[model samples]
Target: MWKITYSIVGYDPVEKEWGVATQSKFLAVGAVVPFAVAGVGAVATQSYANTSYGPEGMEHMSSGKSAQETIDLLTSIDEDRALRQVGMIDGQGNAATYTGEKCYDWAGGITGKHYAVQGNILIAGTVEAMAKTFEETEGTLADRLLASLAAGQQAGGDSRGQQSAALLVVKKAGGYGGFSDRFIDLRVDDHKTPVDELIRIHRIHQLYFSKSKKDRIVPIEEQIAETLDHQLTRLGYKKEDQPLLHTFKDYLHTENFEMRAQEDGFIDLDVLEHMTRS
Candidate 1:
């Protein structure tokens, strides 16, 4: 019954995705707080949390319930409902949140068209900051989610301090190898600056997993080839008789940038920048 945290559950209608981003003084807050399903909804349950609320809430939404109906059903049957706080966004962009009366001081939540922001054991204005940022920020769902989390922390985050954070987003056939719904799932299990660390790791994740735009690909022109050759040599690879493209392909494979690699002699612009930085 010691759960204390702040979180946002959001839906991106343009991408048809649902996600949750949360930070807490509690250890591995990601593991306990965020839950999402592609084509279903997302949930964040905290503050003397009932873990069952996550999966159960999704089940209710999947069974044709709205976000408010799902939350109502969950709180109605729980004997200790007054101790729980939860936020949710259904697939249709309906959002709902509930903060039990008995939750710690400065506890409450706000819901909007496609988001629910909530927290407990926090300084005043945390949820308000989160809601404002989410509404004003423009980018991908992950971008908005992370921005909102940072805003919450800046406004006065968990009174107990921050320890761990997590980001979870799901899309149809978005997982690795296109085999699952886990588009992006990252966690900072324990860190002094968990939100910042999470952001750093997410950048790495995007570089390695995100699809490259066709327009960003450039052919290995004379100057670009020389730069690539020089960089590759510094990494301990000697120029060989094989075509420069072959050598570059080998380097891409070794560095796990194969997803961004192109056939012929073209290279993704971001991948090239990463190579030069390395």
Candidate 2:
């Protein structure tokens, strides 16, 4: 019966990404918390989490149901409705939330433009802190969601203490290799400092998977080519013991910079930045 506390479910209209982030005193809270579908919506179910709310709720939104309507329809049929807590946001960024009357003290939620923030069995201001962070923090949906969770924890968070945390976001072709909608799904199932661990993992995820911004991308100019040639030589990749773009490309391939450059052609500025930064 471990209850979760301090979670945010939100949408990024610019990126068309839906995300949910949660922290709890429960072990493996990620298993029962955040759920999202690309071009559909995101949901968070806690306080006697009926995991069914995830898939079933997405089905409702997919069928053209608004978040509030979907919540009403689902709660209308559940005999144990009063024992649940949930938040939802539809594809268009409309939002809704609910906290059962029987939820433990310090339980409630806030819904706003493109987002819902909620918690149960938490400190009095935990959910409020989360909402404030989500609104003030600027970045991708994943970045804001994770910041909200961290803020909640700093605001006292679950009175019972922290054990698990999760961040899940979805968008069209956001999954590995453009296969699915699961853009980012990182969980700290059991950790002494779960929120911190979640942040660390998220950074690593973006490093390997996220493309550098289009504006920040430096084209392979004369100076950049020289940097690459020098760095590749220092890294022990050489063609005929001399500078070659092909050798540099091979190094980029090993470092997962395929997105920043074409193996046969020009180099990306990010590749040089990454090499130097490392």
lDDT values, one for every candidate: 0.92, 0.86
lDDT of candidate 1 over 27-142, digit per residue (tens): 99998999999999999999988999999998999999999999999999999999999999998989999999999989999998799999999999999999999999999999
RMSD of each: 1.5, 3.0
Among these predictions, the greatest lDDT belongs to 1
**Which tens-of-lDDT digit does each residue in 160-202 have in candidate 2?**
9999999999999989899988999999999999999999899
Model 2 spans with C-alpha error above 4 angstroms: 214-248, 262-278
For candidate 1, the lDDT comes to: 0.92
The weakest ten consecutive residues by lDDT in model 2 span 262-271
TM-score (C-alpha, index-matched) for candidate 2 = 0.84
lDDT value for model 2: 0.86
Model 1 misplacement above 4 A: 238-243
For residue 79, give model 2's deviation from the true position in Å: 2.2
